[model samples]
Target: MTEALEIRNLHVAIEDNEILKGVDLVVKQGEIHALMGPNGTGKSTLAKALLGHPDYEITAGEILFKGENIIEMDVDERARLGMFLAFQYPVAIPGVSVANFLRTAINAHRKAADPEDKGISIPDFRTLLKAKMDLLEMDHQFAGRYLNEGFSGGEKKRAEILQLATLEPAIAILDETDSGLDIDALRIVADGVNSLAGPDLGVLIITHYQRILNYIKPDFVHIMLDGRVAESGGPDLAEHLEEHGYNWLREKQSKATAG
Candidate 1:
């Protein structure tokens, strides 16, 4: 399997305190990889670093997106390179309609794909937007609403997926996309992700619960401990983590150190 994202000994820090110590993760094309862990274990930090968040600094190591070093790339540059990150908390932008935001994003994507004067026309844009919205079961009225303003948690997540569908990114980092969602919303989001899954798209779903795994099974499950990925395996690993919790891992680590 060809690699979509490759991280080599990634060391990240925030305010001089290291959060990710020599972590490595790789996602191949068309694969769903889940990064599961307890709260505050650097899962979110890793996602932030991948998206080039300003506060998180990469103290060492390299992030290769399709063999290109992306650590130094700015957030917009990363997005332009077909990398999308759906935030855990979708921010609200008043006075910006969903329609306008989506159209602008789509235009940006088109511009990145073709740097020439060519771009997706307005009519073609609307058609594509409508088609994706329909796939996500989003209301036509949603187009007129301010971007995520007054939206429920479920609505925000659906909107995120809607953007994902429209952007068709090569690598999608869904950061805790399932948090605060009910069963119905979870199903809808999962369905949206599954429908869009293919050889061209690789997903890294950062989640804490196993419920979402039922809807979209990951090809690989990685457990992030204190500052690094401690374990990795297939889908069954998620089930194990759900049942036994992280205590066993803590115990094992302690014993290994003592011995």
Candidate 2:
């Protein structure tokens, strides 16, 4: 069965500040969805909460991944359940080669599933890593480099996609993957995401702008306002957003409510 990620009336807050009031969204495998909103509108908060971030407290509602409630699960458990988050600013982890880091992570997930199941062999890992790298058109030497060490902004984002490609999560939540990327870099990253998208993977791309959507082509476009989805439509909605901007939507929505 195709996996589904459903969020119902989610309210998340950190310390004394409430970021998400009541947001609802559902993403199904094989579908690409874009969640667009202005900055400080709880986009990243939703992403973190979905990942089961300890800092964010779930004040209300549920996050059901593949029909399982993951509100109380740990971050690793979320990953095992097929949830992945690509950060806007990925920190560099020095002294760890990209291949080694990924191998360790994959083995950890395998061990988590079955303590008795031995980890993937080095040869098998090399084969798998090469396949994923080739799919993303990455240089074979990339795997030998230290993770994010002396990498450009685009390289960091590409590395994140490589992780995504290797892990093959069911639901991929990208929190502003386009941030700090030039047009050329953005296209390459988008191409990587596009190549990986298919029947077994659901993508929720959260961003403040619509440029990425031009390349990614989301099946559904959602606009969030004040922590809730204010409107949803097809790809044209994103085009409309590009032409007019969120202020226009806010005014139109306000007038609709007043009327």
Best by lDDT: 2
Least accurate stretch of 10 residues (summed lDDT) in model 1? 112-121
lDDT of 2 at 89: 81
Please provide, for model 1 over 1-259, each residue's C-alpha lDDT reduced to its tens digit, 9 standing for 90 to 100.
4557899999999999999999999987799999999999999999999999999999999999977999989999899888899999999999999888888887787787777847678788788888988998888888889988999999999999998998888899999999999999999999999999999899999998888999998999999999889999999999999989999988888898799
Span of ten consecutive residues with least summed lDDT in model 2: 16-25
Residue 44 in candidate 1 has what lDDT?
A: 93
Q: What TM-score goes with each of the models?
A: 0.97, 0.96
Off by over 4 Å in 1: 1-3
lDDT of model 1 at position 220: 96
Give lDDT per model, in order.
Answer: 0.92, 0.93
RMSD of each: 1.3, 1.3
The residue pairs found clashing in candidate 2 are none
